[model samples]
Target chain A: MSPVSQTRSPLDWVKTAISRYWGVVGVLIAWQAWVTITGVNSIVIPHPINVVGDLVFNPGVYLANAGQTLFLAAAGLILGMALGTMVAIVAWSSRILSGILVPLGLIFSSVPVVALIPVLARLLGYDVKTVLGIVIIISFFPAFVFTAAGLKSLPPGSSDLFKVFGASRWTRFVHLVLPSAVPNWMIALRLSAPPAVLSAMLAEFLMGKSGLGFLFRQSATEFATERAFGTSVIATVISVLCFTSAVAAEKFINEKWK
Target chain B: MNAPLSSAPATAPEAWAINVDHVGKTFTLDGGKELKAIDDVDIKIGQGEFVALLGPSGCGKSTILRLVAALEDVSTGRVTVEGSNPTALSRAHRLGVAFQDHALLPWLTIRDNIALPYKVAGRPVDDKRIAELLALVGLSGFEKARPRQLSGGMRQRVSIARALVLKPDVLLLDEPFGALDAVTRRHMNVELQRIWSEQRITTLLVTHSVEEALFLADRVIVMSGRPGRIIKEIQVPFARPRSPDVQRTMEFHHLADELTLALEPEGHH
Candidate 1:
């Protein structure tokens, strides 16, 4: 193996990282600059400084809300991933189960969860649970689709290798299936993470007494546009965090493995 | 179809590494059309003989390897490894296979890929044996290199080393060196011959190149395509411990020419 050391210093690496991702950094800077230069009412597009300041000053409020959303989303992510994987394996291994699930999963995936939100709110109540349920439904398809595709996507030669090597069912899953599914799992994770937060917000938007969504609606009604804009800005940051984490994971995998 | 040939006397009279007898196969695809891939093909490989199946593509050469490896079943007849049904053998450590594509696990380093047979079989592999294989394949320094970082030649070497790590009774290679450039292919041939002789394991190579068949094999088995059957078997009486110099010998050329004539269609022959 080659040495791990890179030519650049840590600070230099950070600079390089920012430079390499200039498109994203450029957008952020342009957005902040435009708001600062316009001198418009904070309601339209509050300056990034003010929005960030609001986050810092109201740390307890924002962090707690962010934490709540993350917890529920994480729960949904785990639940959906597990169920989807088992269902996918069953579908791939058995013709009868595959026939049953193939169309059923598609039909379940087709019906919009957003449309079901109202019914969910009535049944599960307009609370964190409803939002979590929404995330599960919305994220389920990617897990199911990717796992099934990943299982089937093993090259034609792979099955032959399996037979020659006498790979047990468990070994096949661990050695072949798991690594093959990593890329697809990442894809599903990326697609699902944002929906977790979005569904939480949607739930809050429909029914809430607290959280960023609640704050936005409260400010909107009171017409304190700056705070409403500030809350929205914070939500965008949460999204950036999700997107960046996925990107980082992808970079790590490509470098370390393939 | 010809009767199954017994193992040659040169290696051993009683012990056989591969015993494939009257093996036949037919595949019925999704459209319900029938495809006969092999037709009562029979070949016996002695304990240490290096046999090559030489013919044009689609001659069921690969199918034979797969059946012996127990990757696919012979719809009729039998393939046994040391008289045991290849599939029934609890551990596949008895056989190693390398196909056209070097199916080295992309996630593992070269060292790890070579060690996978032992890893998956849950047995402690002798590090010394692995090092010897790496040295034989000329891959000692690149153990930590991943498959993607390697050139095609290097990857194939890693695949071979991985196959040999288990020290199986038989080694099956299906067009293993076909994808390499001419220079690399020739180099690999010499390397493979040296390694096989040193290990003394029975080796079966399936290829379309008559020169490759002549160069690497002690005996060449040629097949006819379209309901694939063994058409001819030619023995190379060339001396053991073949090197690069052997490729230019009259014996090598003469054997290659005859096999070429046998492989060609009516007009070309």
Candidate 2:
């Protein structure tokens, strides 16, 4: 029916696919070339093939570690986002509370959060709970800031309309403020997803009994380069998955809420 | 159209639908100096009357409407609605208002936007009433469309529908068609007249357009610039169910010219 439908060809399909995935193809080509030309020690940097082989042969180990890391990240992300949103609601209710906490949130967000991982591990005793806590603290700031902004950024005159309608404070918050804040909340989710995974891995790498970060550490210590590379690959895959899902979620909400 | 309430009862003491008794509004500037926006402005609207406050920009016409809508407190004097404070009327969900911006909620459909006042009043959503309002505003088929999907005039109609969904005792319109183009504005004015004729609610409209004031209102009050005060008042002679042809009459043109002259800067006329 359309010109594009009529002119479409297999070559066009190949061109579209290459345009979409050029970065991945380029990276793989570069990796293989480097491995072939350098003739470097496999112990330091294993071939991509060897890493793939390790992933295929040790699926159980990768799966278990990935599951732990994902669970920790997802659980921590949910807890952190919930706490942040609750605090944002509280801030919205009281100008004095917003004044007190908004500056504190800004300061904490500006600080290097990862630098506090070791201190937190030492203080909280280097357990899985501490790892979860680390991820939560890292993810909390964006949620707070974005949700706070969204709560205040109402449609012009709609606030006055609400007031003139004699809306109770609770009704205004529920019907107007909460819906207004959803798009910004989704933005916070998308921005925080990768950090959630990264922070979970960092926390585990610092000190944890199990997870991908712990697996990488154990493999590196044992001089199993292929297994270490496999863990890195799996972490990359999980982070990408989390980020993409969050982006998709944000898109869905923006369509409905905007 | 329903007949306006008889003048006999309206002539009784303290029987006005809205009473702005010597109201004055002063705003404090950033450096602590005060700017008076309106000075000793007095206005009263009878039950079922449509009164338009015609003024130049920054003349505080909107401030008058806002006071009656309970969106702002009167800086001086008293504003009463039906023998009580404006706040009480609003609290009872008997006040409706539409602003120039047509402030429909972007997240809501036209139906949901019109139904918002019910939800705000903590009442059950009346789908039939919402449907009726949609039909009244000529938006029956657009109930499921969001505000942004509609044109400017359509959005204003949706806003007007939202304002009237509760069948409020008093309606305040602050240049509700101010953002529309000239042709669309005239068309909307006709639509609004049709709609208002159906409801016959007591209304106060703030606008600067002489033709609009002449066409849509039963009484037009002309206001002067800064420190806004009512300069002149004229009872429109045209009958109800007025057609656009009335706007072309010699009487309408003469009144429009007189009002336009009154709106000019003080030394110009």
**Best by the lDDT measure:** 2
Which DockQ values do the candidates obtain, in the order shown?
0.47, 0.82
TM-scores of the models, in the order given = 0.86, 0.94
TM-score of chain A of 2: 0.90
Candidate 1 on B197-247: residue-level lDDT in tens? 678678889999887888788789999977888888987777768777888
The deviation in Å at residue A111 for candidate 2 is 4.6
**Which TM-score value belongs to model 2?**
0.94
Chain B alone, TM-score, model 1:
0.92
List residue ranges in candidate 1 displaced over 4 A: A1-60, B1-15, B89-92
Q: Is the docking of candidate 1 incorrect, acceptable, medium or high quality?
A: acceptable
Give all candidates' CA lDDT scores: 0.79, 0.89
Across A116-184, the per-residue lDDT of candidate 2 in tens digits comes to 877788888888888898878878988998998899989889899999999999989988989999999
| iRMSD computed for candidate 1 | 2.2
